[model samples]
Target: MSPRSGLQREVLSLYRRALRMVRTKPPSTRAKFLLFVRYSFHRNATTISPRQVSVIEHLMRQGRKQIEMYEDPSVKDCWVSKEMKEWNERT
Candidate 1:
């Protein structure tokens, strides 16, 4: 594959940060956070075209804000829907 574009790299960096933050969550609730992260990333994976730089930029900004909110020590648990759980399990 070709080297990732600047926007792609930023998206990946944000995703890695999210996953790392997931590791810091409480063990009992860790799976929930993982599920939420995986589902969220995949849910949007195909929805946006690579040529949509403006849209991609908007989403990356939104993702960063979400990761910031969830990274807080006080945010112990993440809510995942049954559909999300099932989708994650299927893959």
Candidate 2:
């Protein structure tokens, strides 16, 4: 698919995720708001790859549940740094 179409799909998927949060029993309006803000902010940035998008989305979802999903040391290596490009190559 073209880059534009790919990006549109990502944005829509994020939107759906945000919408789904609204149906939670206790009603996490605040959490949904935060999710929407973070999702929109990340979606606007053009420098990140689709792989990075998946990683960030997972982090957001699980982190919202208070899960320590980033405990594995290797996850930090995926974050941007001087070595990030080389790190991506190694993976």
Candidate 3:
């Protein structure tokens, strides 16, 4: 919920931890995953270009809506691309 106040690496570490927690849970999985997704999209929202945070937020609010979209491996890769690279480079 709070903006990342730490260094970039620390911020990314926190983000990954948050995502892992979300993915491992049951009831909180959706909410936490949505939070992670929203945070990712909005990380540079203030300083960077416009993104679909509103849509992501909306989807997060509505549980399991468009849930089938995750079945596509491409989206999953997009999400993990940065993690896989271990850099701050865009996914």
Best by lDDT: 1
Can you tell me which runs of candidate 3 are displaced by over 4 Å?
Answer: 1-6, 27-32, 40-91
**Candidates ranked by TM-score, best first?**
1, 3, 2
When 2 and 3 are scored with TM-score, the better candidate is 3
Q: Is candidate 1 or candidate 3 better by lDDT?
A: 1
Which of the numbered candidates is closest to the native, going by highest TM-score?
Answer: 1
Encode model 3's per-residue lDDT on 3-70: one tens digit a residue: 64334344355445445545644552355455545555455444443255555445343423333344
| Overall lDDT per candidate, in order of appearance | 0.90, 0.45, 0.44
Per-candidate clashes come to: 0, 0, 0
Q: Which ranges of candidate 1 are over 4 A from the true structure?
A: none
Local accuracy of candidate 1 as per-residue lDDT tens digits, 4-91: 8787888899999999999999999998998898888888887878888898888888988999999999998878888997898799
lDDT of 3 at 34: 50
Full-model lDDT, candidate 3 = 0.44
List CA RMSD, all candidates: 1.0, 12.5, 10.7
The clash tally of candidate 3 reads 0
- lDDT by residue for model 2 (1-91), tens: 5556664565566555544443332342344334433444454455556567676666456544432222232322212333433433554
**Which ten residues in a row are the worst by lDDT in model 1?**
43-52
